[model samples]
Target: MTWNIAHTAFPAEHRRFRAVVGGVDPDAIYRAVHEAGGFRSWDEPSRDLLHLRSTAIEVYRVGDRWVLAVNGPSVEAVREVLRLLGLGADRDVQELKGA
Candidate 1:
């Protein structure tokens, strides 16, 4: 399996982070976020703060990729979420060898 990960910083929004992952399984990403206590439902209302964590993260499907947005109080918090999700600044597609 091959996947692409990209990161974008929202400077206007206090440097909030948005990670766009493409060419991967959206369901897998959704499950990971759900297990990490993040919001997975799209029907929920959007607010200034949605999740309980200070670094509020939301995972949703967009086309063939999963868009993970982190809205936190600080850049460190947002980066931490990205790290936890295994998404880095590298946008190159990665391939799995065995599986």
Candidate 2:
């Protein structure tokens, strides 16, 4: 299975991989990311934006789906975060594979 991913126009020193997440609680995902040596570098629950440093990831809710953005374009990092969220490998997508 493949998740939808988008590349933002926002410029940074490195690339960001934005992957769509489904069938998961945002709060649970936040806790999981935190427990996995990730710190809440930025968060605005009112706007559904959460950014995790060290882990270099961000998750934001858009309509019915959640978008997971990984700084530095790390597929393994994305996969690891999904795993931490209790999502199986079947949820893996390659939009960020070569980006």
Candidate 3:
């Protein structure tokens, strides 16, 4: 499946980059994130919900999509996680302003 990642610059306390990712299997993505050294910060199996965070990024499910928030202004870290999550080299990324 093609992944659509819409990212924006959101400067907040420890949150610099934010993105919405579509067309992903939450279960597989969770595994990928976990394997990539991300810790489970939140989990609610009754609702099929979870949140994973590493040193630089946090990933969580929202509806049918996954939301990725970078802890700092580390664009490379974002790309790395997406790669680990199985996004192809040819990725569909939409850069937004004030999103």
lDDT of 3 by residue, 1-99 (tens): 999999988557443443445546657766877787665556664223333343344455676666554332444445555677676423443343443
Report every candidate's CA lDDT: 0.50, 0.57, 0.52
Instruction: Give, for candidate 3, the lowest lDDT window spanning 10 residues.
Output: 46-55
Q: Model 2: clashing residue pairs? A: none
Displacement of residue 6 (Cα, Å) in model 2 is 35
Among all candidates shown, the one with the greatest TM-score: 2
Ranking by lDDT: 2, 3, 1
Model 2 Cα lDDT, one tens digit per residue, 1-99: 999899768554454454455445667767877676566656686234444543455567677776665443556666666666576535544544344
Q: RMSDs, each prediction?
A: 15.8, 12.3, 13.5
Clashes of 2: 0
User: Candidate 1: lDDT of 58?
Assistant: 56
For model 1, give the RMSD to the true fold: 15.8
For 1-99, candidate 1 gives per-residue lDDT tens digits of 989888977555333344344444445555556667776435432212225356655555565555555555655665555565667634332222322
TM-score of each: 0.44, 0.54, 0.51
